[model samples]
Target: MWIKSARIVDPGQQLDFTGNIHIEKGKIKAVEKASSPMPGTMHEEVIDARGLWVFPGIIDMHAHLREPGYEYKEDVYTGSLAAAAGGVTTVVCMANTEPINDNPSVTKYILDKAEEAGLVRILPAGAVTKGQEGKVLSEMGLMKKAGIVAVSDDGKPVEDTSIMRRALEYAATFGLLLISHCEDRRLSEAGVMNEGALSSELGLPGIPSAAEEVMVARDTIISSYTSCPVHITHVSTQGSLEIIRNAKAKGIKVSCDVTPHHLLLDETRLYDYDTNAKMYPPLRTGADRKALLQGLASGVIDVIASDHAPHARDEKDLDFDVAPFGAIGLQTLLPAVLRLHFDYGLGLMQVLSLVTVNPARLLGIDGGTLKPGSRADITIVDPSTNWTLSEDMIMSKSKNSPFLGETFRGEVVYTICNGQIVYRKNGI
Candidate 1:
């Protein structure tokens, strides 16, 4: 297959030009400028992307493809379809499923299901603690052998300091990356939204920013003490960013990712008691949103992930006080990032890097480039297209998105993974 006459933008390679991406046998055989033309008999498939944009397929480091147990909300195939529609060709799924992915068998099961799905690269994350109980260490050595790119007890923090320290040290011995959810259960439990005037006015329980900051600080100290590289996930507060910044300044091996919802929305959106606005580490002040944007622009934040947690309609349509704390993000990630690029004055390359090269580097995956000999995982986007997001267009079984009914400026028209065109928008 040949993608011809497209504006190729690969931030990892510092490349931007009108070019052709030639795919052969599931690999990028060539990435050459338009100056080179193909003979009539050279290929049978040609995609004339005259005015379109082609980029390295995005890698989302924080996604929840609930399989092996909770297939009701989402399965491997459905989640991959949603991801492919969003231009993501690689996704690292959290180990927060019903039967937590602590042992190697669950990891193998996820991989096997993903293999059957055959839409994108699905990497599994192992639980940091056995059964995600935060009490005993998991079978890290055995799970590593089964191919977990990272380990984290997401949706639940390792609150036990001594246990977390030992987990860090043990993970480091196996050369694995440790990811933290950065929330103190005690401070965040039963909270419905941000802890401030908004929660008070709405008569909702509040989750203080300190809930996130306290764990952020603890993880930093543990990383320092253990000499292990730790990654903080979904950082939502200015105080947490400051702590991470200070840790980086001290030469501690630490990294972090921010979610699209945190970057784009604030607590004000919850004034109407929209359950979709409910999220763990709930949105904060306008000032916190500004700080998170600045962190991404200034390189304090390493990448952008969707944290694409999905819930059934019956689960999300309940009263705000009892509704689940998450909103689907797989389909809205690009436009949210584009707002940063086109409106906030961030370079397009920089915005694209947060989803592509940066996340790939964090996971040590072999993607995020259009260079010759790389995998043919690519996404074609139309920057000029204006469209409204709706439930019918969502490929995932769940329609729990905060961005539903909102208009956006960009659209992903096609997604190719492993040289296969897994998703393509209608009419082109």
Candidate 2:
């Protein structure tokens, strides 16, 4: 197959130019800049990619597939479909399902299900502790062999400091990255939204910035002491960013990512008792929002992930205090990154790296490039297309997103995973 006349931008290879990409046997065969396909290439499928942005398929390193138990909310098949629609070719799913992904059996189960879906790639995250109970370390080496790409007890933090340290140490030894959900449960306990004026006026208990900041400090410190690579996910507080920034400055191998909702929505979204805006490490003030954007520009934040936690509609329809702290986001990841480019003025390549090259490097994965011999995972986007997100537009099994009704200036027109066109906007 040949992608002709596209403005290919593969940040993984430091490449940006009008180019043609050739694929054969499900791998990139060549990247020829400012040139037409070779003679006799007409027999191959050629994609007219003119006027579109061609990127290495997006990689969302944090998301909840809710399989093996929470299929009612979302399973592997449905979640993979949503990911394909968003131009996300690879997803590192959290280990927070029922009967958590603590053992190799669960890891293999998730992988098996992903194969059945035959859409986007799914990399399971093994639990940091057994059953994610925080009492004992999980079999990291065993889970790795079973196909888990990383270790994280997302949707819940390992409250025991000793366990967290051990998990970090074990992850380092196993050559896996430790993805931390920086939240001091004690500080965030019973809180429904950001602990500020809006929560007070709405008569809702708030989750304070300190809840996440304190843990960020702890995890970074542990990472430094143990010399392990720690990745903080869904960071939402200014204080947390400062700690991560300082840690990185000190030569600590610390990296972190921000989510789309946290980048766009703030505590004010909760003033209307909107359940979709509710999330763990709840969205903070507008000032924190600006800090996250600045972090992206200054390179403190390493990537922009969806943190695509999904909950069933009935679960999200409850009272503000009782609703689950999550929303589906797989279908909005790339568009939100576009927001940073168009609205915040970050260079397109720079912002695209947050979802592609950066995460691929951090996770030690492949295919965030159009380089020769690389997997043919590409996302073709219509930069000028603009539209609003409604419930019907959501491809995830659950429809609980703060981005609902939000309009955006760009959209994915085609998503190619492993050289197969898994998602086509007009076709879907």
lDDT of 1 by residue, 56-77 (tens): 9888899998897889899999
lDDT of 2 by residue, 61-129 (tens): 999999989999999999999999899999999998988999999999999999999999999999999
Model 2 residue 113 CA deviation in Å = 0.7
lDDT of each: 0.90, 0.90
Residue 349's C-alpha lDDT in candidate 1? Answer: 88
Q: What C-alpha lDDT, on a 0 to 100 scale, does residue 79 get in candidate 1?
A: 95
Query: C-alpha displacement of 97 in model 2, angstroms?
Result: 1.0
- Number of clashes found in candidate 1: 0
Which 10-residue window of candidate 2 scores lowest in summed lDDT? 34-43
- Regions of model 1 farther than 4 Å from truth: 39-42
TM-score of each: 0.98, 0.98
Model 2, residue 152: C-alpha shift (Å): 0.4
